[model samples]
Target: MKFVGIFIILILVFSCSSEENSLEQYANHPVKFAKQKIDNPDNDFSIFIPKNWEWKAPYKENGNDILGLFANSKSNKNGFKSIILVKKYKSSQNSKDLKSEFEYLSKQIRNHSQIEEIVDFGSTDIFNQESYFFHTKSKSDTNGDSEILNFLINGNIEGIYYNLTLSTPQTTDFNTDMAVLVQSLKTFEILK
Candidate 1:
C-alpha cells in the first residue's frame, strides 16, 4: 500500500539522517596537540601531547627510565585518570629486529599478573617505521569498580627502542580516546 511505502521511506530518511549526524559530530571536532620535547640527553625524541594536558618530563619510577608522562587534567566519569607514558630502551645487538623484540615483549606482558587479558595485538606502520601494538585489559590497583585499558605501542629508531603506553580507565568512549591517542602518536619525531 501507499501508506506502507511512505512509512518505510520516512524511516529510512530519519535513520540515514541520524547516521550522518553521528559521523558529523566526530568530523567537526578534531583533537589538538602540542609538540613536547624530551629533556633526556641520552635518547632524544619529541611527541605531540594533547593540548592543555599535564606534561612531566624525565620521569623515573621503579628503575624505569620514563622519558615523558602526559596526563589528562580531568578524570573520566569513573574517576580514573588517563595518561600517556613514554619509555626509552637501548637497542641490544642480540635482538634481531623490531618484530622479534616486540614478540618477546608481548610475551612478557601476557605473563604479567596485572594483565587480565590481551584484547588485541598486531603490527602497524608508524611514520614509515614498523611498529607493534597491544591492546589489553588489566586489573586496576585502585578499586574493583573500574578496570584499566592499556594500549602499548613500540617502535625503534636507530639505537633506541621507544615504548609508548596509553593507559586509561575502561569506558564506553574508548574507541574515541584510542583514535586521539593514535593521532598524537603520529606526530612523534626524533630530534636531530
Candidate 2:
C-alpha cells in the first residue's frame, strides 16, 4: 500500500509540473508587433501588426474600399490560412449604437447557413471604446474535414464603423492565436 501511494504521488507531481511548464511557455513567449499607419485623409489611425505577418494597406477595388488586410505566414497542417481583415464604413446620423449593432450582427450570423455554431457573443470595452465581439465556428468551404474559426470585433470610431475580423482554421491553437490577435487589436489608436 505504501508503494502504491508513492506511485500515485509521483504521478500527481509530474502532471502538475507539466501543466506549469505549459503555462510558463505561453507566458514567456512574447509576441512582437510592427506598427502600421493609415494615411487616408478621411480615416487617420494606426494599428499594430504581428511581426513577420504580411500587411496590405487600405485600398480601393471594384468601387469598394478595404481598410486593411493582414495574414500570418504560418499555415495549419491542413493548409488553412489565418488572416485579419479590417473594413471601414461611414456611420450615418441614424447609425445604431454598439449594442444595437451587435444584436443585429448576432441575428444575421445565427441565420447564416454555413455557420455551425455561435460559440460566444458579447459587448465589451476595447481600447476605451465600446466594442462588440463574436466568436463562431463555421463550415469550411475548402476542406470538409476541417472547420473554420471566426472572430469579429466591431466598433464606431469618429463617425466611422470599423470591422476587424480574424479567421483561422480550427486546427490552430485558438488560445495562442487569440492572445496574439487581441494584443494586436489593443494597439489600435485613432490619430485624428
Candidate 3:
C-alpha cells in the first residue's frame, strides 16, 4: 500500500520533460474548476484558484506574499486543497537557481504542513524551459483531503510562482477553483 501511494505521486508529477507542458494527465486529474484572480491590490500579483473554493488574503506580517485556497469537491468530500505560499525570485538569469529555490521552498512548506515529501518530479514549461514538481501528503492530518502541491517555475516567461494544493474541508480550505485555476494560468500575460 505504501509503495502504491508513492507510485501515484510519481505519475502525478514526471511529465517526461522539464521544458514540456502537457495537460495529458491533468484532465485525468479530478480538478473540477479553476480561476486566476488578482490576489493583491497593487496588481503586482495574481494566482489561479480552483473551483468550489474560498479565498483569503494573506496577513501583512507574513514573510512572503500569501493567499489561501479551499477546494470543494461537491461529490468527494475528501476533495479539497490548501496553498502555503513563499516568494519566487526568478527572472532570466541563472534559471537553474530559481528552480533550486522553488524546490527548497517546497520542501520547507511541506514540513510546515506536516506532510511527507513523496515525489519531486522535474518539469519544464511551454517554451521548453526547465522547472520542478513536488507532491506532499498528510494522510494522518486529514481524513480524506490530502495535500497535493506542485512548486515550479511557471510555464510563462513571466516567471510566475505556482503553488497548487489539494485537501478536504475538514482539515483546511483554500476556497478557490481547482481545475480552471490552472487554465487561468495559461491565459496569464505579462504587462510592462
Candidate 4:
C-alpha cells in the first residue's frame, strides 16, 4: 500500500510537470515579418526572418548564428539581452522538425532567457524543405529573466538556428533594431 501511494504521487508530479511545460510552449514569441524562396537549385526551404535591424559580423564557428545571419553582441553589455544568431544545419533537416528542435535547443543557448511570451504561427514549406516557424518574445531580465523576439526554423539537413535575444537592461527598440538580421534569411535547395 505504501509503495502504491508513492508511485501515485510520482505519477502526479510528472504529469503536472509535463502539463505545465506544454502550456508554456512557445506562447510568447512575436514574429512581425517573414518570407521564403522555395526555388532553390538543390534543397528547397522556407523561413520567417526579421525585416531589418542593426548590422554586425558573421557568426564564428561553434558560435550562435550558425546559419549565416551575421551575429555579434555575445556577452550582454552588463546584462543587456541582445544576441543575433543564424546558421544552416549541416545535416538535411526539414522545417517541421526544426521548429520542434529549436524550442528544445533555444533552451540550450549559453545565456538563454526564461521564456515568458510565445506565439506560434502556421507552418509552411520553403521550396522543398519542411519548415516550422514561430515567434517568441521573452519578458525577463538578464540575471532575473529576459526579453526576446525570435523566428526559429529547421532546414532539412542538420538544423538551422536563427535567433535574436534581448537580455536584461535592453532599452533599444529591439523589434525595429532586429530587421537587419531578420531580412538576411535566404533559402537554398539541397542538391542531390
Candidate 5:
C-alpha cells in the first residue's frame, strides 16, 4: 500500500510539470497564420480573412470614397476594432505596380495626426501580384496606454486602385491575428 501511494504521488507531480512545460513551449513558439477565402459581394474581387474573422456587409458610407469594408467578427464596432476597408478611386491612370501603389498609400497617411509611427513592412505577394505592406500605430482615445496596429496594403487592378486596411488595438494580444491577416492578404485575388 505504501509503494502504491508513493507511485501515485510521483505520477501526479510529473503530470503537472509536463503541463507547465507544454505551456512554456506554447508561449515561446512562433504563431502560424491562418487564411480563409472570402467572396466580394460588390465585385469579382475576392479576399481572404483570418481564422475567426468574419465578413461585414458594406454599408452606405458618409462619402463616396469607400467601396467595401470587412472586419473580424470578434471586433467591437463601437470601439477600436480590427477591420479592412476597401477604397475605390476613379482615375484614368493604371496603378497596378505594387511599389507605386505603396508610395501612394504612404503619401495619403503622412498627414494623419493620430498616426504615431509608420514602419515600412516591405513587399509581399498578394493575389499572385506584388503588394506592399506597412505597419503603423494609431492613437486610441478609449485605450489610453494601448496602441492600435494598423496593417495597410494596396494594389491596382484594371486601372483602379484599391486600398485595404486592417486595424486593431495592440492590447488585445493580436500577434496571431496580425499574422493571420498577413496570410489572408497574401491570398487576395481580384477577377479581371
Candidate 6:
C-alpha cells in the first residue's frame, strides 16, 4: 500500500513537469520583435516571420494545405493578435496574371455573408513582386468583429502560385500589428 502511494506521487510530479515543458515548447514568452527566416527544404520557397511570432504546422482542409504563423498563443482569448496564413493556389496562369488572379480572390471574399466592410488598399510591390493588399471587417455571431489584412502576391517564381495574408481581431490595435506584418511580408523570398 505504501509503495502504491509513492508511485502515484511520482507519476503526478512527472506529469506536471511534462505539461509545463510542452507549453513552453509551443509558445515564446516576453514577446520581442526580431527577424527570423524560415526556409522550406521540401519546397522551393521560404519567408521571414517577424519577432514575437512563431509558425505552426500546416493544416489541411478540403484537400488544400494551409500554413499559419501566429503572434502569440492562438488559444489565448485576449492578447496581441495576428496571423500570417500562407497557401498555394494551383493555376496555369503565371504570377504576372495579377489582375485576373486577384479578381477571383475578390469574388471569393464577397461570398462570405458575415463580412461587413472591405477597404481597398490598392496594389504595391514587395520583394520585387506585385501584390494586392486590402482590409476587411467581419461580423460573426460567435467571434464578434475581426479585422483582416489580406495580401495576394503573384510570387513569379517558376509555376507556383502563392498568397500570404495577415489577420487579427478588431479588439487589438491594428497599427502595431500591421507594422510587424508588413515588415515580415517584405522579407518574403522565392528560393526557387
Q: Estimate each model's TM-score.
A: 0.66, 0.65, 0.48, 0.37, 0.60, 0.65
Between prediction 4 and prediction 6, the one with superior lDDT is 6
Tens digits of per-residue lDDT for model 5 on 4-46? 9999999999997654122123224466755666676777467
Query: Candidate 4's C-alpha lDDT?
Result: 0.41
Residues 1-192 of candidate 4 have per-residue lDDT tens digits of 999999999999999765421112322224344432222222332333333333333334563333343333434445453444444444223434565665555455434545555543334443234444444445553433334434454443454543333222234454343433333333232332
Between candidates 5 and 6, the TM-score winner? 6
Against the reference, the lDDT scores of all candidates come to: 0.59, 0.56, 0.44, 0.41, 0.54, 0.59
The RMSD (Cα, Å) of candidate 3 is 9.8
Q: Which stretches of candidate 2 lie over 4 Å from their true place?
A: 1-43, 59-66, 70-72, 91-94, 143-159
For residues 1-192, could you state the per-residue lDDT of candidate 2 as single tens digits? 999999999999999765412222332457654545433344655676666676666643323333544445455677666666665654334355655555666778889887887665676555566666666667666633322333334443534566676665654365566556666666666555
Q: lDDT per residue, candidate 1, 1-192, as tens digits?
A: 999999999999999765411212322347654545433444567776676677766665534343554445357665666677777655444455677767777778889887886766777555446677776767666522223333333444444467777665657765466556666656667564
Off by over 4 Å in 5: 1-36, 51-54, 59-66, 76-79, 91-101, 142-158
- Which candidate do you rate higher for lDDT, 1 or 5? 1
Candidate number achieving the greatest TM-score relative to the actual structure = 1
Which candidate do you rate higher for TM-score, 4 or 6? 6
Give the local distance difference test score of model 6: 0.59
Q: lDDT of candidate 3 vs native?
A: 0.44
For model 6, residues 24-140, the per-residue Cα lDDT tens digits are 221222334676777654454677786446665353233333333333324336534467766655544443476677777787787779778775556766546676766677876
Q: Give the Cα error of residue 170 in candidate 1, in Å.
A: 2.2
Two-way lDDT contest, 2 vs 4, winner: 2
Model 2, backbone clash pairs (residues 3+ apart or across chains), number:
0
Better model by lDDT: candidate 1 vs candidate 3: 1
